[model samples]
Target chain A: MTSIAIPRPAYAERPWILDWLMTVDHKKLGILYLYTTMFFFAVGGILALLVRTQLAVADNTFVNNDAYNQIFTMHASAMLFLFIIPVWAGFGNYIVPLQIGAADMAFPRINALSFWLIPPAGLLMFSGFLFGGAADAGWTAYSPLARGSGVGLDLWIISVIILGVSSTIGAANFMVTMFRMRAPGMTMFRMPIFCWTMLVTAVLQLLATPVLASALAMLYIDRNFGGSFFDPNGGGNAILWQNIFWFYSHPAVYIMILPGMGIISEVLPVFARKPLFGYKAFVFATMGIGGLGFSVWAHHMFTTGAVLKPWFGFMTFMIGVPTGVKMFNWLGTLWRGSITFEAPMLFALGFLSMFLIGGINGTFSAAVPVDFAIHDTYFVVAHIHYVLFGGAVFAVFAGLYYWFPKIWGRRLDERLARIHFALQFIGFNLAFFPMHLLGLDGMPRRIATYSESSGWETLNLISTIGAFLIGVAMIPFIINVVMAFLRPKDQPNDPWEANTLEWWTTSPPPVHNFDSLPEVHSERPLWDLRHGKTAH
Target chain B: MASHAVATQHKQGLSNGMLGFILFLASEVMFFGGLFAAYFIARADAREWPPEYLLTPEQVASGVKLEVEFWLPFIATILLVLSSVTIQFAVFSIQRGNRSGLIRWTFVSIVLGLVFLVMQVYDYSQLHFGVGDTIYGTTFYTMTGFHGLHVAGGVIFMGIILARSLAGQFTAANHEAVEACSFYWHFVDVVWIALFTTLYIIP
Candidate 1:
């Protein structure tokens, strides 16, 4: 390869620690984002274990009520803000430029700033623990209750706003990089499916996240400056906060999952030995989901009765149409093909089945009557875990395993990966599946204790065991990664025989990202390059 | 290799910097959109403009009229609108390779923006209603106060633009910052028009 001909810059000789701390290189920054977000993931997972242990049996005194609230709230906060959202940015920052055959992100320094904001914000959010207790008002931070929480809640508000800024700028950077920086022949249509999803996700972040910032600001003012934005006694409406928060958050649900869908799309066709079915259809369906995401924010508020229930209900159901399209797109990509069950593919299939259930169960809440039954119950919690944990988390690992060789120039042990996948798949279902029964039995969420006669102890205990199993699942993954790193940079350019431009370059490609380029003829540019250009 | 990237970036017609700035403004729109939606929701829920029963008797006794007085804010609005025009002139000036013209118009725009901010501060001082008075006071101040902050931000943005202009940093061929600053200034102005209509004129 001609990569050796490229000269190293003066700054490349900096101390490795200073190199990491002050680097503006997208690849290094992407690694920083991944490491930081994974650290938070571990922290969030520990908190989840605490939550499960507390709820394992009726009237459990593992943790008292106050600590339990903070535990669960911080669990969701850390997982969603610190892990799921920015994890995508991590993947995008590393992969998008490479896939598009660009040298680096369009605004490389701004890209660094986007990543740097996250760690401090995360520290600030968790710093509440050192003060008194962390924010216990739930990750949603519903008004009235949120208004009265301690300084911890204020810290949460600021942390979220900081996170929102990080993502907002990051979103614009992604949009610009994807939109303006694709290779010569790569039209928007020819761009990789993952980049397309990141594009839609960026649009969502650019538009929806700032609304969340505004909501956080209002909540802050209400708490500190005696503003009455959410205080009903002051002639302000409590539900206004929900309206604004859900407006951002409902789309945020898509922000959390769409890139996962993108990952599944990229992985399926590669392992299946066929191009993705209905690639254009998948792209439009993605755009459809993003557009429809805004209208359905009010669906989260239907139990409040302040919104027009029928309109929101219909819009909520309508969102399922686009989501359903992408599901079929995935299934169609897999049907009647020589599919492999490698680690990435294993997680991809897990995403398909679990995210399918996640989608179907979500449709249940679109029915206003059903939502009335399940709102704020374990069932709602079940739906979130199924989608976020099952869908997004699975895709996250899929992308990680798929790109592991490329990012680090070594392959993860597939045997350990399969073990990791199996334990997680089983543990995930065991942990969350019982919530369906518990919610149907009218066991509410966010409760610190339940009576011995509540009949929830068995299911809760089972779920706790499953949550631990999920924690156990991480051991194989960690071992696999450490073992790989101890070896050497021995991977070839196309380790997975992948179908995009990223695979056309060397694993852990040089500082300029590419030493040479391939002509892009279709979505599967590498595939076409291999197959004598039959693509059209 | 780097030069090759610059070639493709311009294929979109909008430079990456300008396109990104526009998207940034789009987010700013949504931010204010949230505040406006809150204002309207608060207005719809209240039977009285100020929801007088919720007001403190002390507030009433201290001469809080529960009203948004007009003329001062109206004049401030005009200054902001004119500043928007002057910034556009700055952009156009640079586009024609007129260095002195760019500096002169940008300097004028900065003055207009600062005066508008001062007028807003003075207007804020004349108001008897505090942010804690009621939802009326809260929404009004939050929405307009945030807009005031953005205006101050725009002035700072123009300050940098002016300094760059004097340094001969921008030419007719490459003055994306001038264009970006104009877009941001216009967005601030447009948000103000909305705030003025809703908070000052609507009732």
Candidate 2:
């Protein structure tokens, strides 16, 4: 394949700083999203270390109780809101237009607006620390308690509302771009799996994030405006907060993971040397997860006694079916194929194994009796981390490694990537696996200290060690990225032998993604180009 | 290249701008849906429509009624519905190449939107209690205040359209902004009707 030598203008000649701030370029904005979210990830990671350090031994007083609450609150806030959620947006921004063969997002200015909203919101959220103290109401911010917190809670509410607005607008942009901007020959069914997941994720975000905004607004009014929406003293039901919060948040859990599932689906097919096992089924399953996402919100509130436990348990258990279908589809794609364990594939495989545990453990909670045992315990904490960190974060790294060549026109060092993966996989299990046992043995979460006689010290210390190892794992990833940047952009456009429309263009695609796209005949247009068109 | 660009634009009935606006309105629906759910929950839990918990027994005995008067807000609702119609007319006029008609109707819609806001504020002044007075006052103000803000936003949007219309920016072939403005105006109008139903006529 003789690639066209398109003359690209030199970015070095211009002032890149000013260019970045004012630029509505989708690629640049995607890069900004990546860098900003990764920074928050580091902040969140440090706070995690603080949390682990506090709990590493019995009766530890590394920080006072109030400060401990703030630390964990911000940690989850930064990871969930600032990092994991927006990082998918980052990947989607960079890859979706390229995959769909569009030059830019449907609304590039709004895309920029979405990216710009994050930093200020992050600042406002964390700035709670400077204003007396930060929000300690946990991320769920269950009311009467949340209503009673300091002005910091108000800041958190306002910040989350702003972020919700950003996600809502961004989701709309993604939907419009996919709907309106697909290249001429690509039909909806023929679209790539990543795009499919994004489409589903966007729907979840658009409809669900606003409910969170509404929840936050009520919290704000209740706290400041003498409103008694959640104050039981004022004829307000305290349980109303949980109902509205989970109504948005359960769908939000899907919002966090669905795109990661998309990334995995993309990576798996390439590494296994096959087309995706069940393209249509995978699409249907994604929609199924999204449709069922709304019905299971009460599962989160089951122990509160306000929810219909049997109904919520039934719906929550039903969620696993679609999720199981997805799991089988991934495994089926890997079976009977010429597979290789490249960095991206390793992380993809890592996501598969760990997310399985996440899925299985979540079911234990779906059983109302078991949930009664572990509700608000370290076990539930373990369940979330396995899903978000093990599932979403692993896929995030997989995506970063997979797309590094295309986005930057360079490759991350492969050997260092393996080391990073090993440390993360081992460290993650060592960290969270013990928490399940600890919870079953009656160890509550979010506490700063524990008694030595409780038999929890060994596990807590082991978890702390694992947490540090996870922290150590970042060193190799950082080094690999630095090394990749120091080297020249020498990778080919099809470095990974990929099948998507994105790989059809230049390594760092030209300003307008493509000079001309090949006639897309199926989902794997590039594969069709390499090998003659399939019988389908 | 020009032909390729045109082909890529995807000429569907709904313009990308209009589609995006509707999706945004879909999210706005969920936002208001949440507030209404809270209102219903609050109402259900209370022994009375206006829970006497919020008022001092003396104030409650002073014959202060928590019931909302329907007349002024009904008039405001009618004005808002009329504005929705006028904005649609503005969009229709633009589609037929009548820029003057578009500008005139948009200006009238903006005027009606402003009149509705004025009436709402007047109604607020005539309220039997403050926002802090009771859960009834709280839900009433939060829901309607949010709708009022959306109306204000719609007016500003129309103001922009009116300016652009005066500048002759829109055409029969291309008036996505006008169309989007109308969709948003209609959304605000529908929300006001829901609010009027919930707060004024539900009892």
Candidate 3:
């Protein structure tokens, strides 16, 4: 790559710790977000292993039931709130401004404020263990049960509300940045697909997160203030919690994965050596998914006997349409192109294959009758992990590999990446796949153990082995990162011959991102730079 | 490579700061939307405005329905709506480079906002029930209480605008902060009207 000099902020020369703490740079904040969320991911993963250990054999005394409940509850809480949901914001914070050719996020100080809220929130949520016990009522924290849970539940509610506020404001920042901060000649249609997905994701966050906040507040009131928002005795409907919680949560399901799908869209075309096919259709499909997300929350309540069975079931099925459009769009992007099997592509493919199973399995619960048989069972657990772990987590790896050169200015070891990918893919399936059969055979979820004669022992042991293998898989990834740091930061601006605007600048871009952005005449500005701008 | 500094600024309809504030308002709308939805759901599910099932036996034996006073809250509602107008005038004054007018109108809005909060506190003290009393108290207080908080927030927002105006920070061409403050004040005002209808005027 040709050497070029660019101006940077004065704070870049400051002591590293003080710089990170005091600086409002979006890229630095993005890295902070990534590190923080990844730490929580490890924390959540350890909790998963513990849960698996306890459930490995029937009636095994790994942990008492109460400890098991808190463990699993913290696992879901950490994964959903700390890991999957905010990781996209991490990626978005770094990449969106670069992709749009802007200097920083719309509100840089507000961006810092958004990230600063996460650590204290995570610490407070986990601090519950020190007080007495962590929140044992599960992540959902349904009405009277949560009301009766320990002080940990109160801490959980407050921490989640703080996190929600952080995300809400962060989302508003994203929309404004995307809408108003694009470079000259870049229209809405000229945006990269990831920005499009973030746009939709931000819309969902801005609208849905506040509803969750309101529900949490009501829950807090009910638990502490004798408010009857969810108390049946106080003329409050218990279903009210379900209605409001799912209202945010079902949309939140998309908030967790749409960005993953966005990452997949980004990785596919680059590896396939083709422009993303159906770019406009993919954009519309993303918006369609966000729109349909609101209607499908009640599907979760199908077993409660309070919701309209057919309506929610039908809406749940309708979600399949937009999702199917996205799936086909991805397949089209990869069709008849020079496809390569790099680590990012491998993980993207893993997401495609696994998320397909995840989507199909989720639809089974939409049948209302089938949901009755499988609700609160291992089948539901299997479905969630497939989507979250298989779908979103795979894309997270794909994104990390694909953007590592741009973010860190060095390439991770390709050989180690492949090994890491293979183990994670195999171990992920092994861990989650048996739960489907176990669910069908009547192994209920959230239980510490089953009797030896319950016939769940073999599958449980297999899942335990698979879960441990996943833990083992992280070794290669950690080694890859550490090894990459020891090498020279000699990567070119566009190492993969990628097409986005971020690739137009130097690797580990200057503080202002781009000294001079390439004129964007099309969505693929780099492609335009290479091939010369085509006539409209 | 010799660097060429090309402009990255696009011709957006609204400035970044204004757009961001508007988006912030959109989320605030959803927040209040959720609270109001809960209020409506509770109201719809009830056979009576203050559902009979939630009342204490002693309270029920007294044979009086739960009530909110129209007079005090109506006055409070007028004050908040007037504050919105005053904030808008402040925005206009700043846009016209009238710093004194900006300060005057902003101070008036802040005073009006504080008065509205004082009226709410006075009304709360006179209430027949507390937040813990019943579902009626919960929904009523949660909705209006949140709106009251927003009013307080708007007052602070206007105070910042007032301070900036006093420092001669905003001019005719660049008063984005003033405009954003007006937008929030208007949003709080609209929410107050909705709360007035839901809590005070609704029979």
Candidate 4:
């Protein structure tokens, strides 16, 4: 057997700052994304703790109503926009090419541009807090309210528009790279499921984001120019805002979840020591989820009295079937396999169990009667946090642990990783599970304080306690990351004996991903390499 | 056998420039698709489109306005369509190593694109409507405003390609920039044609 020798290019002359600032390299840009998103995640987490503390005791006056509103509003907006979306984009920028056996993303300079646009947009959004207050109309920014609010709402609108531009450019780059820059033998079917989900996610982002931009622009015009796009007095309908907003937002929800789903699909197969059960079924389910996501936007408006209730109700229930099929496929993959409970595996398992509960509760909301009972309650908050925080955030951690070695060429400490996992898992459920009970007892979300006699004191206190524990769990994970970077330990290729093509390369792949692209024999090309049918 | 195999492999992959252009078009389609969906929903719910209170209420309220006046945009549309053709000729000339033909057609396309843009501005000025005055005014201006921006982008693209061509930077094999610019110009042309039919000729 012979190994191909790859020549390393000589270092070019450039300042360190200039090198990163003007970089078209996907790897460098990916690192930039990782750091930026992590910063925002911490900021969002602090806001979360503040909201919990205020709610811990009934009628507590730790913060005034205005400050309380800003905290919760900014918390939701920061976590959803600044953290989750960018984190997925960061991971995709780094790993998708490696998984597909390519050197870098297609349109590399545009990829850099997409990431650079985000920080400025984040600054615009958060700077509002320092000036007067951040947007307090919830992350949804449901018009009339947003329009009537002060300069903070105006800033929020501009920030979202800029972020939409960034997302669109990134989506365009991803589509091109996936379609054109694959390794020689990697066909659409042969590409990893994560890449496929990304392809679908990029398409959804490209299609759906612009509508939101237009809606925001219209709202801007209405607010500034005496236009009546959503003004009831000027012959515009408030219902119009709901329609335009959800047209993009329902798909935006999938944009948040699909990438996480992709991460799990990749993780589950590897840890199960089995080929993914029903590969084609998983692909169809992914497409089904993306397609159905658009039609169900009206489900969010069922309480608004604008959309046809029965029709939205039916479409909403239809979405549940594909989601159910996905759950079955995950369980089927684990059936009778030699499963290892590694950190990544543990997180993936947590995502599945928690996401299932979220899914069931989400279906409950689709039923008109149930939704009426829980419309603005903490129950809805619990349900969505389970999905987004438990489902998406857990999978994100799993991917980070799984790919950290591949990115840095060093192993993260296993002991510290397990401790991080246990604290996070325990703290997460305790924090969110009690919110459902409080919601049923008629506690609405986004309110600063509740009366002592409202019967919500005990539940609120427990939820707050759980939130602090989750914060403590984050410390070990941060330490483990820093230690891994300081100690440069060499690891063998295929450290996990993983089934994907990425594991076949060096721990940290070269600038160009591969010396010569391998011929893919199946979805699990590394499996074929291990069996001596293919060579590295 | 190995040499033959490598040649076959080389033939299979697309040029990066073409792939980038296709992706750009896909994103543009979604951009315009969103605007179109808004138009359809708003129009469907309207009791009297262009409204009885509009500035041109006499003409619109009587419901007897000639659709032919809308075809004035078709003139600008035709000029854009022809500009796309000229740009393609320019790219083809570059690919065939005909520098003179490339230079001449590139200049002609840019001139036509500028003329079309000027006429579009003129058309907007001539309209007896303002964006906030009526539902028709709002939708019409927003849709056309975005389309005009696309045309402006196409003109800028042409300008860049022209500058690079004059510098003698492109070659027979590596003129992907010229090729991509032409593709973009054609895309702008197609979008205008669709916009023309839907907004104007369809009534």
Candidate 5:
């Protein structure tokens, strides 16, 4: 028997900085995204802690009113634009090519460009804090308030537009890569659900992001050029701002969560030791969620009195059906299989449970009466944090654990990861769950302080403690990553015994992913490999 | 040395440039869609569509200016649309190993694209309302301005393909660059037709 030798190329000799600057390799860009997103995550996390601390004691003078506003506003902006979206794009860029058995993303140079735009956008946004007060209007930056603010708001607008450009370019690349670059046998139906969800997400980004860019440009014109796109006195309608903003912003929420859902979809099946329970249903549910996402933007405008309440209310409730179907599907995937409570699995479970609570709270807000009562309160804050942090961030962690081996070719410290998950789950709930009560008790959101007699002091303190616990939880996870990176270890090609085709490739796959493209005959090509069935 | 052979073992598939063009067009769709939606919503709610109060007496007196009189754009649009056909012919000719035919059509297509762009610039000069005049001006200018930018991009692409054809870089067996450029030129032509009908003929 003759054995064929596959030649390995020596690593290219280049200076470190120049290598990163010019390289089109997806993995390098992915690492760049990871480090950049983590940096922003830390900054945003600190801002979150500051907000929590100020709210910890009623009538507290931890920071002045203006400073508190800047802290919370930048926190939301940083977390949403700079951290969550970029991190997910980073992951998608790194993994989707491997998942589909492609050598590299279809447009590798554009992928590099997409990753490069993010840090500059983050800098432009955060630089405002040092120069003046950061944007005081919330991340949503509703018109009259955003318009009324100073140069900081202008900076926020510019930064968001830049980020939108980055997202749009990245999404365009993802869509093209998914459509044209799949391996010979990797049919669309046979592709991993993560890739499918990303495909949907890229479509949404391509279609929706430019609207936000246009809206922001209008806002800029109104702010600086004496245009009247939003100024009521200048024959402009403020509701126009809400309509246009939410048109993009509603789908923007999906942009944050759909990838997380994709992560959970990938994670649950592996832990359950089964093919995904409802593969087609899950795919349809993703599209359904994305499709219905556009119709419910008016729900965000319930307080504004310009929309038809009954119609918006009904559509908002309708959004729950597809979301609920996804919950059931995730649970069904875990129903009877030999379930393992690995760190990634645990985070997936946390995401499911916490997202349910967030979904239910969202439904409550859909009711016009309930929304009117809690419109500007801490309840909305709690609900959003539960959704964004508990749902999306948890799923992000799950993906990190699940794919860490594939990217780095080493196992992250399992013990440290589990410890990190426990602290985060507990601390996350402790921090955010009480805000619902404080909100129902009439503590309005975005306020810098409250009177000592407001009856919200103890809960606020507990939330602050939880915030610090989250900070502590992050320490071990960071240490684990550093340790794993410094002393690299080899992992088996299929570390998770997973069903997906991505597991078929070498860990830290070759620059061109496959030596020869593998033919994909089923959703679980790797499963077929294990079963002694030739997938090609 | 063996690594170079391994890298080239997989026959180079289509150029990534085609993917870039498709992606660019998808984003352009959203950009135009947003403007169209804004125009529709504004037109729907206004007591007087296009707000007669906002128009100048001369523009109003001219009985709606028959948006078609932006006829220079029509000429530009025709030129662009014909260029798409010529580019495709060039692509087909290349596929049949007809080198001279490919070069001839490629040069023709480039000339048509350049002419289209020149006409577009002339049309911009004749506009009665500037981008800052009113909402009508804003919508009109932004939509066509972006489309003009796309046309400009197509012209640059055509120029590149023309240069490559002249250099004998593309063979009959592998002309992905020609195919990709033709696809983009066709897309630009389609977008112009849609813009012309919606912005001019439909009203």
Candidate 6:
């Protein structure tokens, strides 16, 4: 076959600062996304500390009632919106094009627009606190109460709408890039698993995020224009808000985690020194999870007395089947394999164990009677943290460690990574585990204070210590990153004996992603090449 | 070096931009889907369409029926649908290298869209109930109002297309913008039809 015909733009290199500020380049945009989201993660983490501090010993007055509302609400908003959701986009922006062997996203300007939208939206959302108050209705923003909150809620609404637009367009970009920009001989199935998960995630974002925009629009009208969409006395249904919010949000749960799943899928295969067991099954499972994610939004609303409990319960339980399929997929990959516990592999292993607990405890909510007991309690909180912090955050670190050398052309200190992982792992479980007992002890969520007579003090204190320890864990990670950056960029391409097309290029690939293309003959094209199995 | 760095083998079908626009339209469909679901849910929950009895005693004294005005919106709907056809024609013309025909049809479509928006605004004034009156008025105005804004947006889009056409930027082979604009106009028209059926025609 003739060599590919890439259209390289006529170029004069701008100064370094100006280049980044005006860049339509995918790599720079991806780095920008990473830095911005990690900043929010820290911000959100601080808010979580506030929450935990306020709850530490019963009736502790760390913050007043209203402030507590804003604190927890902003914590979740920053984490889910500003951090987790966009972090995957960060990783995807960097990794997807590389994995698929594309030069850049299909729409590079739109990709830049997607990244640039975030910082402003994040500022707008947090800016609410400076003006009277922040949105205290929680991230879900169940209406009526949400309708009447301070001007901050309005800011929250518009900020979220802006975010929805960003993701919606970004999703279309990801879908198109993956669909249209693979290197020769890289078929759909031969595409990296991370790319497949991102494809499903993009589909979810394309379809689901706009529904969120409409919901936010209605919310804005109700809040500002005196519309009655959620006003019960004005003949509106309150449940309508949940229906619309979760329609996006539940899929968004997958949106928040699917790429993390993608990351872990990539990591596990590389470290295990075998192909991902049941690659086709894993892809189907991802699709299954995305599909079932939509149907099971009502599971969140079971206690509202507005949903069909049995049907939602059944669907929620059924979602676990695909998730269960994934568990076996990972285990099968590890079974009888020469698995090495690299930093990335350690985090991947961490995801498997912690996410299993998250999955199991989440299924407990699928049982209607059990949910009735745990709804609006810390058990629910524990479940989410396990899934998000344990599951998504762990996978994030896995990808970060896995791709750090390639992205920065420098490797992180291994001892520090293990220290970071061990501290985080211990601190994470210590923080969230006791919440299950406290929740069963009938401690409600979002409360500013609890009475000491409630007997929740000891467990609460332990959880707070754990929370701070998790804060302590970040020190090593930050140090590792800074330390790595201080070193020279001397790492080779394919540092980990990685198997994707990305490793086929230079570390921190050039303006055009590749110098020359390699013919892909399997999912692990690099492996095939290294083993001399693929024909050039 | 420039010659050696060829574009990678991409799956052949719709161009990336075109496929992206279509996916964007799918998201638009779901956006409208949310508002429609709100309408249907609000409709289902209410004992009456307007929930007139739920009104305050002051609103009752103010003589709000909390109902939609039909005739003008119906006319506007028809106008919007016709605009869809004209925009389609504009796409067809541009595809065939008929630059004059493209400009003419796109201008006609834009004019029709503006007229439809004006008619819808006039219809909004003629309605007895304000958006604040009740859920019925809320859903009615929000859905149609959003749809109306989309129509205005589509008009602006086509106006740009028209401007580009007159500038001689389009040809048989390179008129993706015109095609994209037409897809949007038709989408806005389809949404209006749904709104008209749900809000204006059903009763």
Q: What is the C-alpha RMSD of each candidate to the true structure, in Å?
A: 1.4, 1.9, 2.1, 3.9, 4.2, 2.0
Residue A530 deviation, candidate 3, in Å? Answer: 3.6
Residue-level lDDT of model 4, residues B47-126, one tens digit each, is: 65544443345545644332224656878888888898899999899899887788889999999988998988888767
Q: Global CA lDDT of candidate 5, please? A: 0.82
Best by TM-score: 1
Q: Per-residue lDDT for B1-203 in model 2, tens only?
A: 24233144577578788889899999999999999999999888888776765677866777655778778888888888988999999999999999999999999999999999999999998877767666787788899999999999989999999999899799999888998888898888888888888888887
lDDT of 3 by residue, A353-376 (tens): 999999999999999899999999
> First chain TM-score in every candidate?
0.99, 0.98, 0.98, 0.97, 0.97, 0.98
Per-prediction TM-score, chain B alone: 0.94, 0.91, 0.92, 0.84, 0.81, 0.94
Return the number of clashes found in candidate 1: 0
Give the best candidate by DockQ. 6
Compute each candidate's TM-score over C-alphas.
Answer: 0.98, 0.97, 0.97, 0.91, 0.88, 0.98
DockQ of structure 5: 0.24
Against the native complex, each candidate's DockQ, computed on alpha carbons, is 0.69, 0.68, 0.61, 0.26, 0.24, 0.74
Docking class of 6: medium
Alpha carbon lDDT of each predicted model: 0.92, 0.91, 0.89, 0.82, 0.82, 0.90
* lDDT, candidate 6, A332-379, per-residue tens: 999988999989999999999999999999999999999999999999
- Kindly state the fnat score of candidate 4: 0.19
Better of 1 and 5 by lDDT: 1
- Cα displacement (Å) at residue B103, model 1: 1.7
Model 5 spans with C-alpha error above 4 angstroms: A1-11, A486-488, A515-521, A531-536, B1-20, B49-133, B171-175, B178-203
Q: CA lDDT of A237 in candidate 4?
A: 62
Model 3 misplacement above 4 A: A1-8, B1-8, B58-65
Two-way DockQ contest, 5 vs 6, winner: 6
- What is the CAPRI rating of model 3's predicted complex? medium
Model 2 Cα lDDT, one tens digit per residue, A1-536: 55455554565356878789977778888889999999999999999999999999998999999999999999999999999999999999999999998888989999999999999999999999999999998999998779889988889998998899899999999999999989978889889999999999999999999999988988898888988788876677789989999999999999999999999999999999999999999999999999999999989887789989999999999999999999989999999989999999999999999999999999999999999989999999999999998999999999999999999999898899999999999999999999999999989988889999999999999999999999999999999999999999998989989999999888898667787888888899988878888535
